[model samples]
Target: MRIGELGNETGVDIETIRHYEKIGLLSVPPREPNGYRNYETSHLERLAFIRHCRALDMPLADVKRLLDFITHPEVDCGEINRLIDAHLHNIRERLHSMQSLEKQLEVLRARCGDSHIVRDCGILSELVAASHKTGVKKD
Candidate 1:
């Protein structure tokens, strides 16, 4: 099939397919007699796998490593398990940080009970007072 047809079937953009080829994620296909690039089922399957990895938010390097593993099915899957575990750890850390941020914002939100003039706003006053105490000018 042609590039456009491959892209349509895979639900990936043509430019992204080209980029994958450029980045060595996807192999370049041979051109037909009419000079159109001819893609095969292997390309479609590989592209689908790539798209699934991307949907999982896996990094490109990790995806490449996973693809390499796929190419060599004899390799032990322990490394793949380790990679996924590491990614989960990172995600948990981020979630904890986000929760902390949410708590901090809740505290800040509680500083203001009602709307007032900008100068009389409790949140603004607290921020200004904190900055003054810290010897930092408010931006």
Candidate 2:
């Protein structure tokens, strides 16, 4: 099938498929006489695996490592477990940081109290005060 057909089947963009091929994540398919890519079932399956990994927010390098493991069935999967654990740990840290940011935004949002005037906006006032405190000169 053509690249567009492959993308339609996988819900992936054509440019992204090309990017994956460029980065050696997705294998390049053979071209037909017309020079259009002739993707096979293997390409579809590999693309699907890559898409699933990306959906899980796995980094490309990690996805590549996972793909390498797929080609070697005899190896222990302990490395995969460790990789997933590390990703989970990173997610937890991000969640914690996001919660803290949410709290800060909540406090900042409270400063405005409701719709007033721009001059009476406590949020802007606090921001300006913060910039001054941090020695940030506004252009």
Candidate number with greatest TM-score: 2
Q: Give TM-scores for every candidate, taking all chains together and pairing residue i with residue i.
A: 0.81, 0.93
Question: Which residue pairs show collisions in model 1?
Answer: none
Question: Largest lDDT belongs to which candidate?
Answer: 2
lDDT of 2: 0.95
For model 2, name the residue pairs that clash. none
- Candidate 2 on 27-118: residue-level lDDT in tens? 99998998988999999999999999999999999999999999998999999999999999999999999999999999999999889789
Per-candidate clashes, comma-separated: 0, 0
In candidate 1, stretches whose alpha carbon ends up further than 4 angstroms from where it belongs are 124-139
Off by over 4 Å in 2: 136-139
Please give the lDDT score at residue 116 for candidate 2: 78
